[model samples]
Target: MLEIGGVSVEDHLWGGRIMVDLPLACWVILLLEYLDTFRLEVELIWPAKWGLVKLLYVLDRFLPFVILPFVGFYNITANPSSDFCRILFAIPCMGIIACIFIAEAILYLRVFALSGRSRTILVVILINGIVVVATCCALLARYIALATWDIPRPPGVSGCKGTFTDGKLVMIGYGTTLYSGILVAVLCVYFGIRLYWSRRPGRIITIFYRDGTMYFIALSVMSITNVVIAANLPTGFRFLMAPFQGVLTSSLSIRMVLRLRQGAREDMGLTTVKVPDIEFTPETSGIAMDVPRTRLGA
Candidate 1:
């Protein structure tokens, strides 16, 4: 049996299958989720308003579906050309990049709203987030640039047959992601603490904190696991967790938007799910939103 990276080539084929199947599985589950909550989205987000947040939501929600076909194509297209594999790989990776960037923007809006519209907080976040995301983008380009497809793969082998020499670049990109996610999570916690100390946390505040905590915990664990895998594991398993990361981040981030709107106290002459004076708009379909206004003593 031929060995690649001390693992049998047979196992490597399985990894390729997993890479294709995992994302397909996630998409099926998420599509079901999207359908299940579509009523909520229509009611809570669709009619709220058009804004950056709505745009982010749409991209985060639907972009993965666009990339799913490419994933399947890359994995199942037997004996594809190096150029074809390169193109297919880049398509899905680029879509993932867009998904991740949109997810970050969504998180940024969440943290900003939690800070009560503090200009100081917003600017600080701008600096940190720019640095982290920029680093990630640069490293991702390097990783993809260095990646190669082993043409004429062994008989009975399938998939893109792609591998990169410097998995460290990818590990570093995810490391930056981990750092940025923790910072956002910590900020959410800080604002939550402030709200609790000041008075009874509003219905939305309690919800935000609960969801934010869970998001961060899941993000951290997945990120660390991804980094570890990228560092120490064979290419077969390096990105096995990427699908899960995308599903969790995009799904929960959108849910945070929807749930906040669904639970809003519309009787207070308020519209939109907001924190303090910060008016970050999250959109779906309906749910009776009024003109977005400053809430929580804005």
Candidate 2:
């Protein structure tokens, strides 16, 4: 039994197992969600015309497979060279950024549509995205550059853990994501409230606010939890929430898109049309007549 500092080497290996477990859990979620939602994608997305929304959906839906493998490798592979760890770490982080960008783009598009396709709102979304991407990139770059890793995991344990100059810095990069979600939430509420007061909000409008509110709240809670834990907890556990939060963000973002597309199809397909004077039909009350003027999807 070997001991490093007062802790047994086995205890240190346990930490490596935890890192593997976190990402492994995320792998389960990713697969389950894909199988669960594939039918919906076929019904809603596959037949639809090629457009920005579909592209974003396709990327967000499939990107995880590409990213998660690297993440898994980083955690489960036996002690790897420091150079290899840096490369593996960079790949997953870049993949995460790309996937997140795609998801956020979907949300931004919904917000843009709700704003009646306002150019001003478009500019705001662009600026917000630029800020978020730049901030996260800078922080990520700084941490990777300053990170150091010389210690090797015990023979039985597996991981490519890098000791950060300040582990909290990595979590800080994640916390920056909250800024994007908050701005989107604010835009949603601002435009959403106006629409609510001005008229009987249509199905599309309701979906925009509904999905927006839920998505923002979920991400906000997850981000804050990550930041809090990272700030207060030991550096080893700093990334305890990353996989959980990442899976959640992807899941919520994709659901929002699917719901909107479904709403658009429902409103447009005229499943039940209501005519005031010429009433009396089947057992249906007829679909409401206040659907948004613009198409709800890209």
Candidate 3:
């Protein structure tokens, strides 16, 4: 049994091929949704908060769209030289790593802020994040190194075809999946409880609650789908769903920051989420005059 993408080459010869265009369509829709949101992001959010985290946030916005075309193009093109293959593979690989970590960072910051910036909570989350990222990186490196250079071309397929060289890459893939899934799931629960009990929701918190929940659920489903498909399906079918993973995670990451900033600008009382400043009117006597201030009260 000869396998180029973990599927027996015999399967390709027998006319077995998964519908790769489905994921392409999925990504196209996701990218369109992302682009629709981009204008609001630039106008309402990008101006005020410019930092490393924000940079990551922006990258998360655009990386999935960038990656989708590359992956799709590679799928249709003819086989390339070994060096070219490595370069082609490296682009999406690096994008995936960046997206995961950047999205994770944005999430950690959200949780940290929501937790009232507790040092202990931040430390614990950071420690766990570091371990997950490091382990997954090592696993991915090994998977790529061990991958077969030539991916078998399926019958009737117009373009190049390939997948991970080793099945063990599925382990690393889902490891990262579970890591992000658990973290987002926890945030969803924590905030759900918070949103449930609070009598009055701050504007930013309300936006966070709605968007975060949606993001959490969508990403969780995608990650689980990735795991199930990669582990149990034929190898050709496995890689087809890969690109959509970043779509929501990236969209939500950027949307989180944008919504937060939008909330802050629209609601004067909610500025403390990112930056906190307290203002006081001149005091005539012993008492401070009317002061405009914002603080985390809940």
Candidate 4:
């Protein structure tokens, strides 16, 4: 029985295991949903938006199956100080951070795709990306250092240990927590406004913005949870961190699947998930597409 800050490792691990299973189940369900969406997109939804949505959906499906399980399995199976396990675990954590960055970058591009090219939008995206990347890098560095220094294994923990005296790691963890919190808040506000405005005028914007907001919010919450876990919990309790990451990734994947399904439904007119597919014909090259009604009420 590992003990961290008076919490039993068995209890924590049990909870983590339960939570981790949620994502595994969710991933399978969402993968099927993604395939359905892919077929619909190819059959109905317009090419450009459908293609982008499909790509993101694929990433979502790939991560839970290909990336997350590896990390979780390694964490559970490998003994502490196993060089292979440590490297494997670190690679995926870094991959998670990288995936988040890619998601954010794609969000900006999706917005641009919807709103048309604008210098201001480009600037905003660049700035946000820089800040988020830097924050992730700091967190990664701290995680690596802690894992590498081989902090004293707290009683009952089953895997790699963390540094006890490393102020740097603590600081990095805290910084990551604070930075992620701030970033999420900003994104929420930004997307919230877009969602609101899109609704007020009943614009036919891609469902990407609405769904992206939800995804980011989930990610932000997970990041905050991780930061809190890292900062307050003992090293043995670190295993609990896996669930938060897993949940976040799973939530993102779900959102992608939902977006695809919604897009398909809208294309089929089965529901109100309408996203305008504006065509630029020679006769109406500059004419804007008719905005569809927002489904805010639904």
Candidate 5:
């Protein structure tokens, strides 16, 4: 192993090169994105009036922004051997799983509204979502159990890394990737059919079309990237995947919520959009409501 100015080259898992810099950059960029949009998040989904669904939305959208930075900083500054750091690691792990839960819940509500609140559709989607999320949690548990601290990097590099102890654990990640990709594809098809039938799409349907399509594409790309990285990269390098995923998940979830609320505001003659009920059920609970009003459209 080469020594550079007395620093051992093997001190970093990725040769102490650009790979060491990437996660820091990723954290900075993701944190900045969260900070930039937070004002709008607060305005639209104010906690003062948060219901159960809105509460979940807050946890999904903001929790990553809050927890990830701690994880990043800890990885850089704290001794991994310390009991406290190990204990603290649980926060991000749990936070990440919680965020996924909230995001999927929001997505399910969105589809149910789009499907005119049909009981059959909601039941099917709920069952599928539960299965998918439970599988993800099981995989995540394996990952956490097997996770290891990366070799400490030199100054100016972050080292918060974790990976599966067994290659089989990676197949679980592949399962998650498949689950996410399929979910996004189905949403795309749902919106595509809705857009087709509308013929003359209104502002609301147009918003849903634009937002859901772009978000789906973004998620699909992320899922593909996760698969590639997990399949090809070393276990230490695989830690890179979750930061990007967390950032994208938070941004998409919060932004889509903002857009839906924005359209609802315009429809209601409000100057600034506040959180409207995106998760609406029909009066009869099983009856199909009018799609337009049930949707976030005018």
Candidate 6:
């Protein structure tokens, strides 16, 4: 039996040798709840897009919650062997993977909309998704194989298997994570350069100041966190995935809220086109008129 934070892994057995923790189950539920809340808000304000994309995001946000609990309960009641438990766990893991891809899709769409460019962003997202999916599949397959073959469980846990030991899976996951991090960095640099080059003399402020920098920064931070988690891939990494996913989803929902609020402000004629200390030049061709500020209420 293994212990983590006073929780015992004694009773649980998977594949005739591995033990699963109750805390991990609880953590998954909490993450699902957070994602559900965020998804509800996003659904209310999701931008008009192709029908299939909309459908996918809706399913991505809701399906995990619906599926995970059933699998968890089934595993708990059945007390299945490690092989069976690993198979059951694959369901939720795949669901989470789907959600991550959905998030990447949303980000790609938003970038395309903002830049008015097509195909490039879509291709990038597609490539990233393929890599991520392939990596996850390899990981799941290896895990199942190991459990079925009765490989010795990692030390300190009777029946717990290491999910990140597969080198191909590790490389794939880390590659995607690193790619995301680099993409975010590039975007930030591009925006910063745009902001600098567009400075106009004498003009204190311009509507371009309202670009959604907060949203960009939030995404960048989340991407960096994902990279870190992927790089580490420690035994506890899975536990951190849910919370980071929740935060990322929440940030996206917040951006949606800000967009709606900006629209309302425009309708009410409360949006000033000028700011006292900012300026814009003709070179600022692609700057958004609705730049989201930290103090949006002001």
Each candidate: RMSD: 5.4, 7.0, 7.2, 7.3, 5.8, 8.9
How well does candidate 3 score on lDDT at residue 242?
58
Please list all clashing residue pairs in model 5, or write none if there are none. Answer: none
At residue 139, give the lDDT of candidate 2: 83
Candidates 1 and 3 compared by TM-score, better number = 1
| Top candidate (lDDT) | 1
Tell me each candidate's TM-score.
0.84, 0.84, 0.74, 0.60, 0.74, 0.54
Error of 4 at 235 (Å): 1.8
- Per-residue lDDT of 1-298 in model 1, one digit per residue for the tens? 7854455788777776777888889889789889988988876677656778888889999987787678777888877888888898778766775676677778777777666667998898889978887787788777778887754456666677766775888788778888888888888778666644656566566667777777788888989999998888776567677777877788888888777766564434444444222253222211224444555332
lDDT of 4: 0.51
Model 5 scores what on Cα lDDT? Answer: 0.59
Candidate 5 per-residue C-alpha lDDT over 196-280 given as tens digits, one digit per residue, 9 for 90 to 100: 4645554555665576666666666766676677677665455456666666766777777777666655655544344445443
Scored by CA lDDT, what does every candidate get? 0.73, 0.71, 0.61, 0.51, 0.59, 0.45
Q: Estimate, for each residue in 189-267, the C-alpha lDDT of model 2 and write its tens digit.
A: 8876665565676665676667778878888898888888778866557767766676777888888777666665665
* lDDT leaderboard ranking: 1, 2, 3, 5, 4, 6
Q: Candidate 4, residues 1-298: lDDT per residue as tens digits?
A: 5554345667656754654565466456646755755654444343336555556644654555565565555545435564665675576666666555555544555454443455775687677667767776776666665564343445555544333343345446435544643554465456445544545322223354456657666666666666576567655344345434544555554454455445534543544435544431112211244545644432
- Model 3 TM-score is 0.74
TM-score of 5: 0.74
Q: Is candidate 2 or candidate 6 better by lDDT?
A: 2
Query: If candidate 3 were superposed on the true structure by all CA atoms, what would the RMSD be?
Result: 7.2
Worst 10 residues of 6 by lDDT: 201-210
